[model samples]
Target: MYKYLFLLGSSLAVAQPAMAEDGEITVTATGLAQPVEHTGQAVTVITRDEIERVQGADVTRVIQRLPGTTFTRTGPMGSLTLLGVRGAPAGQTLVLIDGVRANDPANANAEFDLSQLNTATIDSIELLRGPNSVVWGSQAMGGVMNIVTRIENGYSASVEYGGDDRVTASAAAGMTNEKLEAALSAGFVDAGGYSSAASGTEKDGYRQYNLAGRARYHVTETLSLTANARYTHGKVDLDGYPPPNYTFADADVTEKLRAWSGRVGALYDVGILKLNAGFSISDTERVGDDPSYPYSIDGRSERAELFGRVALPGQLALDFGGDYEWSRFSNAPDAGKAHNGSVHALLGYYGDRLIVTAGMRYDDHSDFGGEWTFGANGAYEIAPGWRLRAAYGEGFKAPTLYQLLSQYGNPDLLPERSKGYEVGVSHGERGDPVYLSLTAYRRDSKNLIDFFSCWSGTAPLCATRPSGFYYNVGKGRAQGIEAEVGLQWAPGLSSQFAYSYTDTENRTPGDVYRGADFARRPAHMVSASLDWESTMGLALGFDVRVVGDAFDDRANATKLDSYALGDIRASYRVNDMIELFGRVENVWDQDYAIAAGYGTQGRAAYFGVRLRK
Candidate 1:
């Protein structure tokens, strides 16, 4: 059925007036430094050009188009996305920025809003599906997402302004004549939208400013030193809405986050061994002002990691690394502390026709003892342009401080664990205009934790609202198939289409998670895009996306129906220093919710001009 659907999608794409051929650029996919042709796992990439064309409002909008992925938005700034490879929880996925981990330490059950990341500075993003903990460790039970930043060799600047209360201004300058290269960038964005049920009413959705810089110097022909620094701060006015009233104005509710993060690393290459070591740190502060709630939260996370890889004679490669992380969280009402240490190693063989990898890591936490995870992956060339790959891995997520020591907490909760496997094949001829990839995977989780019993009667000593206490309850499983095709059909005209089918179920009995299909696991998803690059310096693009039905509430009481969305974009190159562009979202005027409870922007269009040097 998926193959037939792909064929039909392909035909429609080809019928489009505009499409272009695919380009060649080997990317980092196999946890290695060098670019490789075949990946041992399902991988999807979004380029900067594509991001600009789509005018993607957030990370959710950009990632939903990928296979085996689903995003649920609670509001403009309140969003939780589930990237399931087979059927893993959203927490099973790991996100990285320039090789540094960025998962929130406050929550272990939900994914942080990917949209919080500024897109203006992103060069490219890589989404790898299936178990990758062998190389990434811990939360990588489902997949890994690596966001790479742009590297500039000279000065470049751009100014963008749009409707819907959207405006962004950015500039970048760098220098690299021969041996040394450095760059710096700054960006700011502000947007306002309707406050939920209050149609015609205004709300403060998002306002943020960011600054980043990087430098790299060649110490020798085979060695280099690189460093990067970035700082961002944002103030979000929380539109705290209760059940019926979608737009409840809470003048007292305001959220603020400030962060300072950076990385310093060195890389050396010798014929027999390749070495890389890096140290990264991110300090974050979160504060909330809600008179109705009453309290302020402050958190500080300090992390240091060092790793190296060496290749022995033959095709054998060995990687060993260790890390230490410390976090001290203090609230105006109280304070807590947690620290972690880990050591890991991976062994792999990369030959002409086949590659095999195995790895393991031991993690120790001041609060949760120690846990170990291991995995194996392999890929073999079956024929020209055809490769078969498989992977099996075990991953886990330790309970967060909020879960273990919240106002109503549980000290007996254990870390959730998952075991998963995936098999797939990829066929693509080098330089060919067409490429196809398919994958199937399954994942099972145990010791699933959820808020359990609550304290009855509002006792001052035991204040446990319905939020419940964290407990190890049910078991869950997920399986799915993903297929993707890309074709540059002829010239100037090209198209890309992807489809996914997922089946998710819960075996956790009891009132907590009884007889419910995972909270936000959409059963089916698809994305298709067509583009025409005119020989006359004109570009046109169209995209369609569909997400199947899924439950919105934890109890599965409210059902959010499936819906399809479409968008169009075009650009005209007027001259060497100027270009005019416009984009229209929800072209069909489909009234849909990108996230439950939050009203999405109605059909809207924006036109803007880009000035560059």
Candidate 2:
């Protein structure tokens, strides 16, 4: 039955008029600008309008609204935060900033920290869930998040001040003409947050500043050159164990992070063929100051890519791309360099009622040699106002430099691999009064690297390497159902509800923790929101989220209780150029911790205003 469904979705379907959702265009799915219907991937697009409506410093506030998505924060707003999808860890999610890979290569797990990003200067965001390594090269075993900064012709600014002595300010200006388009933006945030440890009394503080710029020059009617760059610097107070007790508690420590990325590309479009070529680079440095232990880590990555799509007869197109990337770490990895070269191709069929795409990628890594991945997805209109969709994708992640050459590294460690399959049915158009979707998905991963102990017995490098070593000895599987409903109950009023149920297990045989539930992954997650607008220039919104219990340790020795949180917001437009807004977060002051011994924020309120022209 599944094979028939896959074949039918990929090749067999009748022609008809395109649906409303097909009008939306995206570039993350297949590395080409195409209508949403052209790709068969599970994706979500967060528009700028929604970003403005949320009006929060932390972008995770809005990201958690999506089904099968969740985040855990070590402390308040600016502390270390990690996101996961379908029970996968943070390191498996690939993050891109204007086409530049932003994952830090110096980190042991090579994960992108969400705490370094906010909603200040973003124009739009695209989240591709599940394994999509065929389009994005590595670190995409879980998903892909593309953060596209604002590039518009206008002037806008905002300022906000609220609890915890938080102060926020941002501004952007741009110019657009026939031959040239350019923009620049900057933002700053300073907040006195609470301590990270629940038992601590000292308050931690966070500060960040960011600058971004974009430009595009049209040299001819069908040719254009584009460039964009971003830089961010952050400082956060931290807490750690003290010498006497060595317990998780408050201590005077601080960490600073600096990251910068840039991309330059050219585009050529003549209706029949579209091509995009670019070179991108990213660098990150982190310095931590502690009384007992101090450290510094620096990482750099560079990439060159070229991709294009050629339209053909019979409503078909061929998309192809290739990329070469190199990265290195300065500290723990001991200046080791890593390289990967990849090439991919996809064939897409676009019909009135059916849209499907199938692609494959081959990656050559300096450490692991070569790996191949394949992805396929399709959507078919079963009847008026109804559709069915299915997708299958494979992903792989090469061992990071820190994992391979660090003090506890094991050179024999191999790459991790994953496979994901999803199928779903939906009713009504995306903007219709009543729209609903239900999807079921499963993902399996092998060769997962975990920390191995050398205390009990002597392993290969255990004699010299007193610290534990990393080994490819873990396996995992996650299966889940996601449901979403959107309703326009009345004029100027709308609501949305999303729920996720995930079943995750440790699948490594003969392991003490095998068959146990995955750590930090809740079994159930629910979120709902309501928004209303009136002609009188007034808007009101409310959001509610409830998460189920989760274990903080794979051994299930520590449990993190489930909790519910709510927020209310309101905005009023004084005129076309000015607006006022405010929100009360944690309205009930529910005290809960996402991680063991981590403190959480209580009730907090904020107010702000915006000016645009």
Candidate 3:
């Protein structure tokens, strides 16, 4: 019973902007767009075209092709999907949706749910691997994901049907002009999904819908106003232990979610000086009902942010920013409020062949007082097309409101903290005939938060509360090597491969799980893909993904077996404004599960048509 009480469940959120070219791609996650090479950071960008080239119905398909990336889903599509960079947990990897912070304020772990995110209206995804606490501040322990939505002058739509009576449809339309630009998009999904429990006999269905809008108006030559909003709603069937048997099995259970984010901002740019200011709001509501227990979460958050960049003499620049947020949440009879504010500054030198940067941050939390963070990174071009880079960052995540105000909340909990270091060398640029890079990195995290049980009699607080409360008694270390290679065969043909080797150890003293591998973190992961496009408006692609063995539980008692899966996708252009697409997933009908006791999809196929103008 105690094992079941561990922190469990997953979701994803957060975003920034990014633009890429063959070399010196721009990374906008820092609030200021900087060249990836000059920023001394390891980043991977997935464009809309790349998303279509890969087997998809979602963004996860393309996200897994990068090193130091791992994810898991409890069931089939629309399930609770979680992501991790290197060996960090889901909550440590912040996600941004169109410049808005989307992490769920009501979640016990304060993580964003990625299950509801689809690529239907997405234009690009940028993953900044490793911490850059100087800009991201809290929840930047692992990495950051920046997602940009389509907001150009155009119209696009797609519809598809697959196995198990699955149907997906999406449409987007927008306008762009000299003075003002605006766009909106919507998507829907309905599926007669299979059972979630491996031993269940009945089907568990799922239905979801989402909407997004973005607008920008040029008020002056050097000033612009921007606004964006996103909304998602979903319902899914789940399984639970029944009363009579009290065993892990199927039961009458369902979960419903309603979440949204909105932001209004202004931008000012005059070549040497740039400024960005914004105010945003995020809200989430969730309901779960089981025969045994029922629970609901209501949360809302608001934030105001401002950041600016000023160029100095001799290829030098100074960047500074600050943000304040207020969050409130309710879990039935219990309610809580939290406030946080942070300020940061950075100085950088952009020489012709060498770039260096350093920064520091100070955060004030109403619940836990204050903390400080520091970061530095540099990159040097050893040759014309090769470079050496390294980075160091310190990060901390404040306790969620739920962790401090709920029934089991602990008022004296400390913020979780981590330190990360990485260095690597690379050859060639993106799209080159041959591209290769490898990095070895390490991270140490302490004061990690976890549930402490009264039954264990570990803390004096058990004297008053009895059951359990959130506490900071966890610690660990993770180190790894990540490598990727890409090769271009013919003009329209290319292949890419990526691999990761991670070693994790739970280092909390006097704990049973100490020295054990981190739950859900595998030792190795590999991905390979091949793509071909002809001048005749035809394209074909195939990919294989492999995940090594891991443990599904902290005790490492349950072993998760290794699995490899393959997929094939093809698209044919019918005209300039229309196209036909289809894909076969889980070729060979490989039956496997990312979460123990969960059922996975068998060999399935989906066909669709796309219209664009």
Predicted structure 2, TM vs. truth: 0.94
Q: Per-residue lDDT for 499 in model 2?
A: 95
Question: For model 1, how does the per-residue alpha-carbon lDDT over 546-588 read when each residue is reduced to its tens digit?
Answer: 8888887667787878889888989988887677888888788
Predicted model with the maximum lDDT: 2
Residue pairs with colliding backbones in model 1 are 18-531, 18-532, 19-492, 19-493, 19-494, 19-531, 19-532, 20-493, 20-494
Residue 483 lDDT, candidate 1, scale 0-100: 91
lDDT, residue 346, candidate 2: 91
How does candidate 3 score on lDDT? 0.82
Per-residue lDDT of 488 in model 3 = 97
Which 10-residue window of candidate 1 scores lowest in summed lDDT?
A: 12-21
lDDT of 2 by residue, 1-613 (tens): 2223322222211110111124555677877666655566667667778888888778898788888887888877778788898888989999877777889998888988888786877877777788999988778988888777876579999999998889999899998888887888888999999988999999899999988887777789887778888999999998988889999889988989899988777777788997777777889999889887788999998777777789999999899877777799988336678888888999988899998889899888888788999999999989886779999999888898898877877888788999999998887644469988888999999999988788876786787688788889889999999888989999989998889999999999998999999999999999998999999999999999999999999998899999999999999999999999999988999999899998988999999999999
